[model samples]
Target: MHKPVLTIFYQFNPWYSTIGGIQTLINTFIKYAPNEFEVRLVGTGSDRTQKVGKWQEAELAGREISFFPLFTLENDNFRSLIPTTLKYAAALVGHSFASDFMHFHRLEPSLAALNWQGEKTLFIHNDIQTQIKAAGDKNAILWRRFPAAYFALESLLVRQFSQVFSCNTDSAQLYRQRYPSMGDRVKYIKNSFDNEIFYPLSRTEREAQRHELAKRLGLSEETRFILFAGRLHPQKDPILLVRAIAALNEPHTHLLIAGDGELAADIRTEIAQLGLSNRVTMLGALPIEDLAQLHRISNVFVLSSAYEGLPLVVLEALASGTPVVTTRCGETPKLLATDNGVVCEVRSPECLADSLQQIILHPENYPSTSCVRAAQPYAARTVMRDVYSGMFTRWEKRTLSIAS
Candidate 1:
């Protein structure tokens, strides 16, 4: 019998990740894991109180996952993540000593499993300091003292892990650029999505759903709804989106802004000041299920954030067969390459509006389903198959060498 494997993740926006790309990877792992290995997953939920108990668990076909949400959003304090991480690490080490491998998504939580010392792999979600640096442009003070701890996972930290899995080549290149000594250790792992949930709906269904949503939202059939489905914050450039929408010369083009954030009020003010109160709809913070429905109803999907780590929203939109336009954030190169989505200049509404106008009018020509299906291979099942096959080959070689 083989020892189990433990997968760890950082779930800052827990609700979003649960329904996003990483969720697809986790769920896929559950669906098609090999019998030789048992897998346990751990995540830090938004609320630390949501940690796993006996009654709370995730049931996959092959294995039952005992999950504990270590730290919650409300409970983030000084070293809270550190101590809570240690507690979970202790639990995994003490009771689940059979775990032979620990795969991590973010830097901090992986530190908790530092002592497990088995085969360790860190997935580069993004360069946190780069994001903070970009965000600092708008809110100078909050990030003025950006913590030194999270600045860059340089040589020392990179060497600590046995392997590194980056979301894209750019992310890996950044790491290699920062820590050339460990350049050979980092690898690329594309995010995945399930085609079943994300594929294009039938024309009839889409038309019907759009009609009903239009009626509910007081939109007419002639109204063209351009969408921005993300947090309304300085980091996302909601004002840029507003300015872009205001610049559109196309008639009947409306902007449906779904999601809420610290900058919601400010973005709303900007919209009003631009005289787009009627043209722009602010559908604040929505459920993931509803967000998908909105995508199905949308003419085009647009993301204008200043930073990202392979944002799953673009994938989700592409999966829904909705034409998309995004900025060259963290992993935009890979995303645009595979999905054929448009890349626009970040924080520039003029560029965004032009892209949006092009996507909306000629959206039918775009291969939306191709974009959705492009994510299938990176699903958990596919990744596990590759990992296990490679591991088995390596193990056999080591055993053969020993026998000789």
Candidate 2:
């Protein structure tokens, strides 16, 4: 008796080793998916060639999940994506016998998945159009050249899948508006996090972890810290965080930044110009263990992003029992609706400073348990696994009914 096989068509093979929001989701699914269902991944490579590789076995949750690779032409750019989509679509159609249904991680690969003969589900993590607009002249040349074509492709892909899952309500609304025919097919599924790795620590355990982090960062144990963990990019608005911290000028308050990107130098300059060099420490990108420890020890977690698609870090912080002070971005309003943290206006250092000060002055108001409970519904193993299982069952029944 063969298990029901679900084929996930993605742009890249996010084998548990890689680090990203989507990779984390893939890993979580693999770790907790029902035993009765077998999962396989199909993806394209970065190489400038056009060929489909043989199916190979990869491990997920101590079980094997077969991986099929479709080589891309050139740099996986717009010019070469046409051929890549054709090759992958052909390969998927040829291997239709291997999969019961298909899952797509983004619009880029769904174009190919649409050609395959199976039920398809699409997971939309971000609003591409919003991001393109947010990018705002950063890559003017590329945007000018491909904006129209990209929009056409995106519009088509959004309409092709009958089952669409978005991580936030905002994206779901956008999808429904853009493709009214999709109707209730667009769902708002919150992103998940590993509760085992991010759960609240006991006071004793937290004290120990705080000591460890303070020692590692050469800080005094008495120093209260706020943590920010994400890429140091324009979209993330790390500089705004630095500016906010500087405006506060609280002697006992320190800001700990984890993660590195193009804005590292700019952040460093802002810290210096604001004379907050001593108050700020950029720990660069941190390993999962270290990041969890930082969350466990910090008095608060901060996110000053210009935009987002329901950031996993906020959930991670909440799971670790740390209150968050974040700019109103993406699904943050919904996440914080439970009184989990403070919400500030985007790109407003004054507002951010005020929110942080409020949390600081009344730290006891945000209970550790409240923060932890707010995160329970988004646990990686629990919520996301159930969502996938429910969808798979519903899709299976729908397919059977159609066949009958």
Candidate 3:
């Protein structure tokens, strides 16, 4: 039997080179995809040295996948997105002709493929309107000033796709209610974590990893770490996390941030102002292996985001047997159980601090086994199998319709 060719597109570099939920999701899907399907990736190449429109080959888990990189200015600024959006859309239009199916990770790329005649699938990473409202002025000028325009655009573009996947259940339901006609096409798909890399370590093994991490960071092994791994942006509310850490007022408790973004300087300033400079450490962006180690050793993983989809880091933390204390956003309220973690109010440092303190003070309440068990349903292989099966089902239906 001939394999179907699937082209996946996003407006960022390949997952291996970047760190984010969308990148990780695309990479995991490709990694665990059925052996019978051929996959190709299209993304932006910000490296000025690499020429755009050139095809490159990358190996993931012994499988060679084709990658086409487009030229675009990569930055957090709103103005920068215009060129990136145009470039990704143009590339999708060109690649759609040869692809058996086109899969888009986020709205921009999916909207760009509106003109494509082939089977198209979109993965909505977050509730866009909610994200905009939560972000307030921190969002782009256009989105912040006129959110209705963006909402209308999203409503228009979403209807054009054959299949739509939302990582958050709440967001999925919201979409279903908003677009009753396409409710069946909009499915809720959980973001997954690699069990092999993220599973919990034995007590002794975890201690060893903790010691190694402490030594590398020049901290004492006795220091209790609270890990925060995500972009340091307004939407993620890293500053709120810093304020929460200050409110925590636990001398032994230290904060370890593993990602970098435009708000790095602002976070540093907050740390200094709060006299948490000594207690807070920024490790910048880390490799997945390093992040997994951090997860295994940390007392608790925390996120103070204004909004989210189903954040992969939270799932990975649970898989590593590390409980999480995150704000109520995305799928967290439904995903987190009393035995696994706590959910705090969004943008409230006091609430965040209280929740973190509860988890830190009574770790036994949130058993490691319970945390790991909660993550089993979202195992990368299992989720990816379901995603691929769904896609093939849709493809089969389209084939039969064409034949008839």
The candidate that achieves the highest TM-score relative to the unseen native structure: 3
TM-score to true structure, per model: 0.78, 0.83, 0.92
Reference-based lDDT, each prediction:
0.64, 0.74, 0.80
The worst-scoring run of ten residues by lDDT in candidate 2 lies at: 73-82
1-404 per-residue lDDT for model 1 (tens digits): 34455554544333333333455455655556566565665655564445543224656544666565543444322223234434444444433322455666645545445556466777766655566677545442233254554455343455777678877677788877777777888778666544445567877898788777777777677776777877565666778878988888888778898876567788878887889988998987676667878877778888787777776677667777777778778785455643346778645777888888777777666665666565556544466778766655654565577689
Superposed model 3: Cα runs more than 4 Å off: 46-50, 72-83, 90-98, 140-142, 396-404
lDDT tens digits by residue: candidate 3, 1-404: 35778988877765434668887787787788787788887776777665678887877766778877766546522234444565566666654434678887767566556677777788888787687776544543246666788788788888888778888887888889999999899888778998878989887898787778778777887778899998776778888888999889666788999987768888888899998987899988888888998999999999888788989999999999999998888888789999999999646788899999998889889989999999999999888888789778877777788789
> Could you tell me which 10 consecutive residues in candidate 3 have the lowest summed lDDT?
75-84
Q: Write the per-residue lDDT of candidate 2 for residues 46-95, one digit (tens) a residue.
A: 43332357667767557677766765333331223234444555655534
Highest lDDT: give the candidate number.
Answer: 3
Instruction: List the candidate numbers ranked by TM-score, top first.
Output: 3, 2, 1
**How high a TM-score does candidate 1 get?**
0.78
Whole-model alpha-carbon lDDT for candidate 3 = 0.80
Inter-residue clash pairs, candidate 3: none
